[model samples]
Target: MMLYIIDSIRTNNFHGEQMMGKIRTLWENASRKLEHHQNNVYGVYNDYESDYRGDYSLSIAMEENNGEAFIEITSSEKYKVFQVDKTDEQGMFKTWSKIWKQEEIGLLERAYTYDFEKYGPNGEIEIHIGAV
Candidate 1:
């Protein structure tokens, strides 16, 4: 899949609950002035300062020929996909945190590249972790 996204930088160090709050706020603001062409939105992290902090960029889906300014992202390679159901009261980020804490399974994240979240229409979330 391909995405045409509006970019922003998130530099806060908040983790867990605090991070989720910030993420909601960020998505609200990022999408406020934009139009949604698809049911799924994406949050792409291109630069990682550490495990839980980085320059986070949010983007809504758009057509390839849409005459708007956007960063184009294409899912051309294999990535590890993690799902968060809409029915889960704890939400996507919290579920991600829990997954991140499980290091014994040996699923190493490719932090050098971009990682992203695909938010579905039914509120389901598919987190694509860049993997080596």
Candidate 2:
């Protein structure tokens, strides 16, 4: 499906540049730019130049285009889903840490196409990693 992205950035996990700070700012700006009415919002990783270690773009998006920038992300047949409790402030990062660890050890064969985080309406979360 296609996602209407509120904001976007190109960054990589390597290189001294911080992903969290940039992502936080992107979401901050996006929240101010549009009126969100979706049951869930998505953090979509796309435009992959290579694998997870390579540069990619992250967008805060929803189902409707609403004249905003958008990207197409489809659900794959195989995935690794990580659930995060809404109350844990660091749950998001911790889940990502676990994902990276698995990828580092050859546990995750990534698709390098689209990975997304679903922020549920009830405040729960699921990090979906595309698998090859």
In candidate 1 the C-alpha lDDT for residue 48 amounts to 65
- The true-versus-predicted C-alpha distance at residue 38 of model 1, in Å, is 3.6
* Lowest lDDT block of 10, candidate 2: 67-76
Q: For every model shown, what is its TM-score relative to the native structure?
A: 0.68, 0.85
Which stretches of candidate 2 lie above 4 Å from their native place? 16-18, 34-38, 75-77
Error of 2 at 86 (Å): 2.3
- In the range 1-132, model 1's lDDT, one tens digit per residue, is 555655454554454446656666766776664455455677776656655554444444434444255554556655777878667787775767755765335555454466778776666788887776
lDDT (0 to 1) per candidate: 0.61, 0.81
Candidate 2 structure, TM-score to reference: 0.85
Off by over 4 Å in 1: 13-22, 34-36, 53-69, 72-76
Q: Which pairs clash in the backbone of model 1?
A: none
